[model samples]
Target: MKSSIRRRVLLLALLPATLLALSLGYFFTLSRITDLDQALRARGLAIARHLAPACEYGVISGNNQILQRLADSALAEPDVVSVYIMDRGGNVLASNSLKQSKLAGIQPGDIPVSSQNDTVTVATRSNVLFFRMPIRQTEVQVDDFALTSTPAPAIQPVNAAPLGYVAIELSRKATMERQNEVLRSAALLTIAALIATALLALRLGREITVPIMKLASAVDKIGRGYLDVRVKLGGNDDEFRILEDGINGMVSKLHRAHDNLQEQILQATAKLSYQASHDMLTGLINRREFEVRLERALFSAQHQDREHALCYMDLDQFKIVNDSCGHVAGDELLRQLTLHLQQEVRERDTLARLGGDEFGLLLENCPQDKALELAEIMRKTVEDFRFSMGEKNFMVGVSIGIVMINHESDNVVSLLTSADAACYAAKDHGRNRVHLYQMQDSELAKRRGEMQWVNRIQLAIAENRLQLYFQQIQPLQKQEQGLHVELLLRMIDESGQCILPMAFIPAAERYHLMPMLDRWVMENSFKLCDAYIAPDSCELQTWAVNVSGASLCDAGFVQYLKSHLVDNPALARTLCIEITETAAITNLGAANTFIKELKSLGCRFALDDFGSGLSSLNYLKNLNVDYLKIDGAFIKDMADDAIDLAMVEAINKIGHQMGLLTIAEFVDSERVLLKLKEIGVDFVQGNWIHKPENAEALCKT
Candidate 1:
């Protein structure tokens, strides 16, 4: 049978108490009984010893009356059952009881007779105790008159002869009664103790079982999906209280999770029909649905008199908000602006989020003039809307392009391109304006050129034509710092011509592709160092790689770098990551955190294009960097321009004051180099010092 906690507790608590009480009672009772028996035997032995000496004269004189008197006196004492005096022949001479007692059968020889010392012996018969002793006779002296003048004859004592024996019997009735009384009292006390123990055990069992039962019931309810159920146990702050708190906390989490689940379910239900067609972030129709609707509108315009307008709206300050405050604020800004934009458009108009800070609005049966007015309203709505994130607030503006869908419309792709080109024209003319598409828009040509560059960049990355190069940074102090170089990225065109970052970096940054470029640079830089530098030579070589502002603000870039470092941990010490001063100053907290994490793994950091930011010196103290690369603009003309020379001198002094190595770029002449060396610049790098070398071939060699 399964036992309840209460029952088990009761048994565990009561069993030992019962046994202890019983054991103590049994031992106490037995001790009392034994004491009574011993006391009775002591009284019997004392009576026998006294009666033997008292009957000594009587036994030698043959006087029964004297012996009778002595026997009577012994019998007069308490618990003395019988007393008898006997001769040496074993004949009873005197008795205190008419009935023959067991002591009368006791022989004189039964007790060892000692003339010099009294002898007493003891025995037990049924409920009586017997004490026997021997009586002895003293010798009479005959020589009494001796001459004083002569030497007195000494009289010597002799051992006396046995005259008779005396025995005493004691009844055990009173002692047995006392033992029975003690047993009764002890048994009563044991029973009372057992009852008290049982009561206490029952109370303790309840105290334990009540909390357990409450917990069990609460768990059952929770298992049945009643998240609100809580186990509220009342007690002092003990283990049970801790258990109660834990259970309640668990239930609270479950309740919160249940509520969140219900909310998600409701959101999922509402999104079921439109999820395929809408943007999950902004709740607007997605790009695919917008394209589909635009295609249908184009077919209608080609066949019938129905006209439509497509407006491409792009936010001007969205990137600033995104890169500065991160993507969370960017997403919220998009959602809020979507709602405001919806209010500006007609109910029949289709609004969709194209991608990243861009929105598309489709107006059916609307003329160019009405479409222009509607686009203007949306532009003003966005321009007036302020987005808030933490303590920072941002004002955003939209540059919109509106194109009328008519019989002249060719296809969806051409229409979207024309609209996009017009949008670019609006952004160029200054944002927060509306522009209509024209065939000869000059900005459209530039936009197309940049788009081509974007394609070329993508193609270069795919074809593995992106090249890694290094520019040597020479130490003017002649320190044995061993090969120190800054790694640079380049791309090759399909025509086998090399393209500098200046040709394609702006397009890549605008399209949010810098993270890809950064990953490639970091991965290949590590490979070059791992192959070129021996494991023991990592400390002798220092290689620097530039990380763009876009990659620094990217959320996953840090994790990607960490994973790569985990793979080639030895390469971390040899690599130095360089970030522009403007990028670090703009994102100080993230930059500091990034620096600390990598530096913990033995990687070093340097601030590139230093002295370029307005708050360069103020923010430099906050950034943890090992080296400072003076801005090339200041270094380029420092040899001739006194103001530029002073700037270079001041930046170098500050960099050294803060315990950092200073590197001057664009050191194209010995005059510039001598000036920097005089200013205590630690390193100089330019065409004059060393031209760019192919890093891959250099590492292989």
Candidate 2:
């Protein structure tokens, strides 16, 4: 767990000492180079001091040849490349060089003169060194040169006069070469020591990383579910050894957990799936699962030319027993009937409870007549059987409708609708019998009417024949402003008159066309909102547009809504999205995600038709909604009914507890509004509050 194999610990261990040694040697070599520079300057000064006195005799005599001969002698010294004699006026008198060096003109002010020691000037160019010194005639110079064969004590002057100057140029190649040699030796020694250190470091790295490598390998194994992996390390009492002990202990615990986990995970995963797709009270698949399988069967029939039959079964008198003997007896009757019905079908066939007293049967590879015969048998069996609950006997019958599945069965809805109509038709004629669905039948003609509405709805959406109307959601408290509005969609009928959703919404929803209609209402409502409203201190305006559950099921619909929201900030800020409690409950996870994504853009969500589902209260906690629109059925009669009033009060209290605003729908009278206000309901919607008006009317305001 500490780290992977970078060997940084080993490298860091030796790094400081290596750097100290390198830095010490580097700085020492630099100091030696500086000392050599000073020594070269001293050597040049000595050479110039020696040559100046010799040139003094020549300068005083005004003889160029004598000066040249003296310069030539100076050039013969070690490292001397050029020699020059200049008068006190700073004019070059004589010069000698092995490589023909040119010296720049010197003037009187350029050469600074001094008395006791000849001032030395040093200049270097192109690796050649120049040293200039003033030539002073002191103690008579070389006039006594021939007279004093007795050495002359290196030209000590008693009184010196400025005669001329002498300059010498020397190369520093030899000194530089010596410095390079020393540096090379030091580098060689350092390299040898570093090699020894690096070898020691590598060996130490191997010793340090060996146990870590084992731990890493064990971690890899554990990541792949091999929890039995453990570190086989010794008891050294070191940190790595302690880590090994900890890892081994963790592995032992995980191994026990993994064994139990392996046994339970599969069952837990199955339970989750079953809860999502099946009714808990019955062992049969729910509507969503049944539709999913039906869609699959239709695809099979279309592609592979397979034959199947769908039987729609509705219990004739199950509600009678449920009302007389209570829900427990009704549940017992359904469970007992499910067992008998399940036994009547083959192992390959699927028997599903489609809610309430209704069930669905899918018979694969069965002929039309055979499916009908099987349906009759189920009907007769249900008619003959009597359910017993603690000495109370109950009888129930089932109406069976069988429809053949073929390539012509295009979708699950069409097949289910046709089968359902046939079952209802059977019940209309008689209580307990099997009926077959026919295309030319009156039941099928009614389905045709719904299908015709599908085309008209599509036309209405595309042609903008759809109109938006806003019904005000008023705060029951007079102090509170009712700035919020819910958008209602209206379609132009064949007679060119405005028609309510009741005329076309059922067909639209039944045929999966609500998504399109919902989109139309939302788009136009936002357009109207952008045109009409501006957010200000006086109001925080919001227009609520209903989002269909079908739209949430579409993975692309959220993105589609987001595309519009991204382009229109005003609409995103002022619009509120409303979804039915049933729709939100049906797609709970997706609804939560949808609300969150849009809410982040400054949009709000209202749970409309609230308290409609059996599990409505359970969903409200997880929905993260802004408004709870109480179901109209409870609110419409709340003023007359005590139970309805109590229910409204309870919902209002719960909504407030969850930080939600409660809106009561269908509050068409002042009496209902008074009751709602007493119950602390936040908002109300009804014709009495504000009649639905065209969304375009907002633009006029």
Candidate 3:
């Protein structure tokens, strides 16, 4: 709108100025021509008056010498083309030149005589004006008689009334041509002036618009999110000066606003993130966030083949602190204890709250002994740290459980559970003490084997040492129900031993190798389904590979799985991914998104170890899994333990209600199988049916 106004103003200003200049030039030229014509007429009339007396007197006496002299003098005028004299009889008497013969048909009466007293008769021919004047008796005194009359008695000149007229032919063509030459020069001057004015206007407009355009562009860039843009002020002192000042002001304000907005966004995001991940009371990472960080750290450690340790801490007699000092004081004491722990720990370690009064620390790139030393430092720090609540001081101490991670840990969960178990062991031995995980213990050894198996699984993936081992999940109801094989991952180690996941899964998880291991299993299982499985036999039952918490949380791992399927498109529909309820609940956001993404690609998900976690119902609704694996603990004791039987029955009932297939693990006895069948489990797996074996062995079945 403003630009339109400027354009309108410019047109208004330039148009009238141009037209007025041209009109003034035309009028000025016309006025000068009129004045020049009047001046030429005045001069022509004066010359004709002066020459008329000479013609009348000189010609009446028949004095050719005098007439010629008079004509010569009259022709001396600049505008006079010619002068001539003639007798009353219309005979030429005298002339300025011999060209009078060209006027043979012209007589003295041909020129009109002036009616006014002193005026000349002006006649025009072609572009020339003839000024003819009659010499009166007053202007010309002639002798009364000719020389032959002798008496000269007041004799009127014979054969001469006015003698002859004096005629001066002035060329109007020269006067008009001179006027045109002046007009042409004026027109050229006006054109040059207009061109110069236009150039000046253009230069001025550029000086104004160029800097303004630069400032406008800068403002646009800043609006688009570039806060660093600044304009260079050009050299101008008019409105450009004002514009520079205004733009500088706006830029300063924008910079401030940008900084303030950036700070506000950062603060808000940090606050929300902290609220989501940290314990409100202790200001430590919550269980969910801790697990995520631990998983990431473990994965990094495992991938680099580096050793790290996890320490789980629980405050001893924390209930006593709450009981004695009230919960408020207890909370303050926890805060104080956390501060002390942070002070004592190294910057590289992560200290997190695992719920209640429990805390966990991740010691990255640390060996067992070093982890122990750090744990001792933390223990002593808690024991010695003084807590105060409104002038009342108290003391609190924590028990520590340390688990050193190697290549053999199954997953992060196993490490956490192992460390938790070790923490319980510390509590059993005595409060305010530390305990390290020893592989010699049967449970710890099993966990260690699981961790080692995860490494072997990862190695198998990189070296192509992972082979698919399928086991028949036979139906107890009907023998001819056809074979449904549960796909298992077996890693061929350096020693050529086919290592089972049970031997290394817990370790893989403990050391954060699960996602890599799960990916390997998925790739190899799908590859085998494409290569070996016969489509006609048993419909080549879909194969399920277990996915760990880390794998479920991994956003990129889903893409990896998709890429594998793209490489083997035929196996994509036949493959299934198995995840535990605990894994799904640990990072619900990531897990749910990953599951949905894979599901879109024709891959399926099952909730393995369904009833083991706290949020089973929540995951079941959120994850939309196709199958639920009844935890082995409940299935192993289903025949003997009524609680186990009831739990299994409840899971099966819920699974069916949710339209999910139920698979029971660790169905080690016929009685267990019979019970699972009665409980309506959709699938069964255990030593009683058939242990996990090589694919070749399962194919023979």
Report each candidate's C-alpha RMSD, comma-separated, in the order given.
Answer: 15.2, 18.5, 14.0
Count of backbone collisions within predicted model 2: 1
Report the Cα lDDT for candidate 1.
0.85
Per-residue lDDT tens digits for candidate 3, residues 1-701, read: 33654465556556766787788888888898988788888888889877876566577678888888888888777867677777656666777742443344477656554455544677656676777776544432456555875553453333335656666677677789888888898889788877776666566556656676787777788779777776776795767678777777787888899889989999999999999999998888888898898787778776878888999999887787687779888877778778877887788878888888899998888988888889998898888877666666677778888988777777988888789878866876777999888767765555445555655666777787878777666655455444566787777889888766666666676678777767676666655665567545647556677777787667688788877776655466666777777777887888888878877777777888878887687657777788888889898987999999999999999988989888888888889888888877878887778877777664455
Clashing pairs in 1: none
Number of the top TM-score candidate: 1
Off by over 4 Å in 1: 1-286, 300-308, 315-358, 364-370, 381-397, 404-410, 417-431, 435-444, 479-481, 535-540, 553-570, 699-701
Q: Which is superior by lDDT, 2 or 3?
A: 2
Clashes of each: 0, 1, 25
> Which lDDT tens digits does candidate 1 get at residues 308-399?
99999888978999898999989999898888888888988899999988999999999988998888888889989998899999999999
Query: What is the descending lDDT order?
Result: 1, 2, 3
TM-score of each: 0.53, 0.42, 0.42
Candidates by TM-score, descending order: 1, 3, 2
lDDT of each: 0.85, 0.81, 0.75
Give candidate 3 misplaced runs (Cα > 4 Å).
1-37, 45-82, 86-92, 97-333, 339-397, 401-432, 436-465, 473-481, 494-497, 509-701
Among all windows of 10 consecutive residues in model 1, the one with the lowest summed lDDT is 110-119
Best by lDDT: 1
lDDT (Cα, 0-100) at 355 in candidate 1? 90
